[model samples]
Target: MSDAEVWTFNVDDYAAKLQCPTLIIHGERSDGFEAAAQHVFRKVPAQNKKLIIVDGVFHTRFYDDPLVIEPTATEVAKWFKDNVK
Candidate 1:
């Protein structure tokens, strides 16, 4: 099998082992793995985990659009500040 195919194993077991704070960000309009992201979020054992779904944005917009990136950046910065220390 290809390397990517070989890596396509179940990660729920690995996610359950996470002990550090985790922040999961998804786009509300994303046609990607948003549902899978939610599924993993439910399985994560971290007490300091957070999930944020940005409204009115699609996947990949967060990297280029200022309207999307601004708020997303704010949320990420706040999350790091609140959780990392």
Candidate 2:
């Protein structure tokens, strides 16, 4: 898929179909995705769902910075630990 295709993909359209446990993690400074992430979170039908916003981190930092990655990884692990069955 191309970047254009990814840009066109409306995750909200598939949010209701997320019947399984879902973990929505984003950076606090992800101005572009934060609202959309929250929207998807609200739309998801999963009984077990969560949204985590890592402090002082931007979208890309969530993938790179060690300070940001550690706690975020912990959160991801905890989410999987609590949700994956």
Q: What's the true lDDT of residue 72 in model 2? A: 85
- Per-residue lDDT tens digits for candidate 1, residues 1-85, read 6889669967798789998999989987898677888999999999999989887779899889998899899999999998998
Whole-model alpha-carbon lDDT for candidate 2: 0.85
Pairs in steric clash, model 2: none
Query: Relative to the true structure, how large is the alpha-carbon lDDT of every model?
Result: 0.88, 0.85
Best by TM-score: 2
Cα lDDT for residue 19, candidate 2: 90
Q: After superposition, how far is residue 53 of candidate 2 from its true place, in Å?
A: 1.3
Going through the candidates in the order shown, the clash numbers are 0, 0
lDDT by residue (tens digit), candidate 2, 1-85: 8999998988888998999988888887887778877888999998888888776778999777898888888888988888797
For residue 38, give model 1's deviation from the true position in Å: 1.2
Pick by lDDT: which candidate is best?
1
Model 1 poorest ten-residue lDDT run: 5-14
